[model samples]
Target: FIMENCDELMPDYLNFIKGVVDSEDLPLNISRETLQQSKILKVIRKNLIKKCMELFSEIAEDKDNFKKFYEQFGKNIKLGIHEDSTNRKKLAEFLRYHTSTSGDETSSLSGLRLPHEGEPDRPFYYITGESREAVANSAFVERVKKRGFEVVYMVDPIDEYCVQQLKEFDGKKLVSVTREGLELPESEEEKKKFEEDKVKFEKLCKVMKDILDKKVQKVSVSNRLVSSPCCIVTSEYGWSANMERIMKAQAFRDSSTMGYMASKKNLEINPDHSIMKALRERVENDQDDKTARDLVVLLFETALLTSGFSLEEPGSHANRIYRMIKLGLDIDEADAVEESTSEPVAVPKVEGAEEDASRMEEVD
Candidate 1:
């Protein structure tokens, strides 16, 4: 019974703790594993977990101590929140993350998004990547940040999955900046102007879609970009490029299982950029022009790379880049002349070499 209670008391998240319970009063048939199924043992387990949670709550109230403790075992706490449905909400309150607002400090994900006046509805925006700098520098955050949105930087591998499990916090939807359904408000004139621009670039968007048919779900004018020429965004229900990259890296993950999550992404072109304007003019004038087609392909591929999506054909991308460089240098395809080899130097005929060989053959 004592061993059973002790076993029950240790929470899964605290499995790193090791201890032994000894007692003389034990039935010969009752094994250590058998004692684990005891009803009374279950009660002890629940009580122990409750007490630990209370203690953690108290520690959380103390910011310095909690920070120190979190720095040590925060990953385990996040894991517990992910695995333990019963205590997920409670564990989540204890979670902390880094945000643009915090600078070097950390803040709770729920507290990051506060109702601000004169701002678009601030859904809890987050950007996930391999590192904090990667997420910070992501094209995904560029316009969002300019538009006054606070983005949570999730650098850990488990961060994206945790956000997925969380879905929402404190009445705000946790929306990834890289995912679809991003909307921004515009004035009537701005809206009218964009509609006109859309019409103007309709041919360009169509040609872009055709060029990237297999690589992208579609091409459209971007409402999110402020300065970037283009970026990629996933479908509303599809996995972010970051999540897809993470899942694909798992050695045991099934590729077939990822099909639904790894759906095609939309390429968003910033109509305000000169490149977009030039491409539009070119497409409108001559969609079939090889230079315009090459530019479209290059832009789509550059957007793919910058938007965190891995290229399906890296060699092709490199070749396209090489062609663009050659074009920039005015080096025509025919200008790539192969190096000449010196005519094979005639082996100096040794004086009487054939005569010596014939004499040796005769001697043999």
Candidate 2:
């Protein structure tokens, strides 16, 4: 045996690959000093890693066995994506992900490779969350999915870390669908239409921004929504909702950095949604309309959840929902808190009880 453990050579996750590594090139009586600093051992280590990668490739060809192998070591590959810089590209090719279009199946990066003939354009879209259900049900995918495009769903806790190192693959940058300024290539007509809507909703956007001034960075027309009214999205490189949740779950996370890490999110409203149309009319009529302001705040809160963020002001959100219910039921808005109609219970012979206690003490 060359050595018992090769954690320094092999990835920590691949420590399970145990076997007799007999090298004729390595001396039989190789001392600890030689083991610590041997060029031959480094070469052998490199060859072993290459062979393992080749083994992974071979196993990948067989879907059934690969599933079992991957179940045991898939996280290792994800970890390697961040930890192994030498073979990151090769490791990325082995990556299997459940995309919006893959249904229950997973696709490799090679399978979804987009054309990279353009001038460094066309980014690969991805979404990160706590589970498949959470990732797939996000409002961020509405328009992207509507356009017959697919987004990789990253549900694992370590996925965010893996993806940070996998910034780009084969010239295409990996981008999250839940970030601001995500503009897909569009036709001139579509671009013109978007600009026209932006012009039309200028006043509404201003009013919404003013209402959500403290809660959001800005309110603008959405480029990623087809059916949803609004959604909260982080800045281009801001921490994702999943990442934020993971950080908060950590016992030793720095609270000061959390605020910095959360960064600032911007609210986006779909210009074509019916709610937006009505809200625009209300804003045009009166920017300070109480109903319009309430609706705006409520939409922002709901968008916070739809985009996988916890509400910072749940109490206010609840109150707004209650107000909506009251409005729906035609309840009077000015109703005051009801006073207790039952009279306060009279003190039941408390004075006599004190006098009796005093008489007993005197007798004693």
Q: lDDT values of the candidates?
A: 0.78, 0.84
Clashing pairs in 2: none
Q: Once superposed on the true structure, which residue ranges of model 1 sit more than 4 Å away at CA?
A: 1-11, 17-33, 36-39, 113-121, 339-364
- Name the TM-score of candidate 1: 0.85
Best by lDDT: 2
- TM-score, per-candidate, Cα-based: 0.85, 0.87
lDDT of 2 at 116: 44
Q: In model 2, which runs have C-alpha deviations exceeding 4 angstroms? A: 1-3, 23-34, 113-121, 334-337, 345-364
lDDT of 1 by residue, 226-247 (tens): 7889998898777878888888
Best prediction by TM-score:
2
Tens digits of per-residue lDDT, candidate 2, 136-248, equal: 88888888877766799999898989998999988778888988888787889999999999999999988888888888988888778987899888887779888888998
lDDT for predicted candidate 1 compared with the true structure:
0.78
